[model samples]
Target: MSTTLTLSTFDAPARPLNIPLPIDPPEGGWTWPPTSVTLIAGENDAVLIDTLPTVEDAADLADWIEASGKRLTHIFITHGHIDHYLGTAPLKARFPDVKVVSTAATAGIIAEEQKTKRDTTTYSAIFADDLVEEVVIPEALPADGRFDLEGHDIIGVSAGQSDTSESSYAWVPELSAVVVGDIAYNDVHAALIETTTPETRKGWIATLEEIQGRNPQVVVASHRKADAVNDAGALAKTIEYVELGDKLLSTDPRPTLAEFVARMVEANPTRANVTTAIYSGAVQGLR
Candidate 1:
């Protein structure tokens, strides 16, 4: 029997920690919201982590920032995925002074993808026409360093490799919190990897361990609720998911992608999207 887990309400004083972004391609029957964006407020200024998947959601976040009476000093792009970065242009418009930041690798990918979409009309049709015109690539930030903002230090960690050459993680020491993009997913699902290697996965596991060692009281994931992370529990669950994918890949007469996905769903019915994402990642890895 599958059990339902209810998340407690997350209320923070400075700004709303986790704001659910409406999921697109809504026919997938995904349980939890597909994307989550976080706002980390300091004494003087605030930082907005990954914008949502849509313009409306990004506007909502901007409205919330305006209401908080804190200037949005910076906007952090966790990765280069469309769902995470596509809504940034509007957000930037709302806070014109806020510096949009991302890792060098992610910045390059964003620019390259934007150019490709413009060059090939075939792929351009995949995105909404309005969105294509509004897309704005963010400036690149140092991969591994700390930035002083509003009397608080924001640390950036280039944890491991992903679709982009480097994945950036943001850590706020004062809050004992970290905004980990796709590096660590919460109760949702892993993202489909455009580029990932076995060695990279191992390195990602190590990075997770390092983050856990910091004893952060709160962890804001890119796609799930922002709350306290049971380090051991979350990491263990990720290990299990990755191990299952490895097992499925090692089958002598390898199962078809659809078959493997079906098996995963059967094994963990409650985590439907997560199972599907894992299967998708594994299939991509095989290719």
Candidate 2:
């Protein structure tokens, strides 16, 4: 049996709270950051990686999955970030029997985040009319750490702390593809709010190097460039952002957030989500 990999991207709506970038964004406003989801479809079954935050987006995703004419055996979340997994509840409500799986570490975070569920306050208080109002926790997958659909296998590789703790990627060896959640991003400013040190930055780069070592033909990320896909350039750009961050910050004077944004924006002027980088630039670069 043969298997194919498909991609889906859900661009989030603008947030109610405008990010306080040091200056007006290059485009003079915010960019709608997208959440990319991947589907591994085989002869008899399929596996989906990641979900968007909004109910409307996730329902569209569920419909897309159902229209594929394949049974969704498992939905694997690459990490536990609220935006990545918040829609799990709605997705499951649509596909009641589908198993929501995450790494053991991600599962812990989900359990804790859902237990308290304070994160939902932002959406309810502000964008109350936009999406689902619940968090659905996922169970840890089997100890073997692989999902088999039809006759193919999807392996999970742990990319520790690239974007968040307990983060990982789903590798489809048979198809030479890997769904690299936030461990890698393309043409979009990465969220460095979590990785805030030289050591951690190196760790982030190392994880990308690990993915490069596998030499997958396609690389999929949670946030991607317009019309982007899993490829060598995508991987290299991710490595570049982390490397540039460490180098620029290591220099004397420790550029302010605005200065850092100026340098980066000059180099990659066309990348969307410029506001995201500017918004978190100083904080991500500083100690």
Per-residue lDDT for 98 in model 2?
88
Model 2 poorest ten-residue lDDT run: 12-21
lDDT by residue for model 1 (116-221), tens: 7643333234333223245568787764656656666777666665323467777877667777777765565554353345565566666677778888776766
Model 1 quality (TM-score):
0.75
Best of the candidates, TM-score: 2
Give the CA lDDT, 0 to 100, for residue 35 in model 1: 58
TM-score of each candidate?
A: 0.75, 0.89
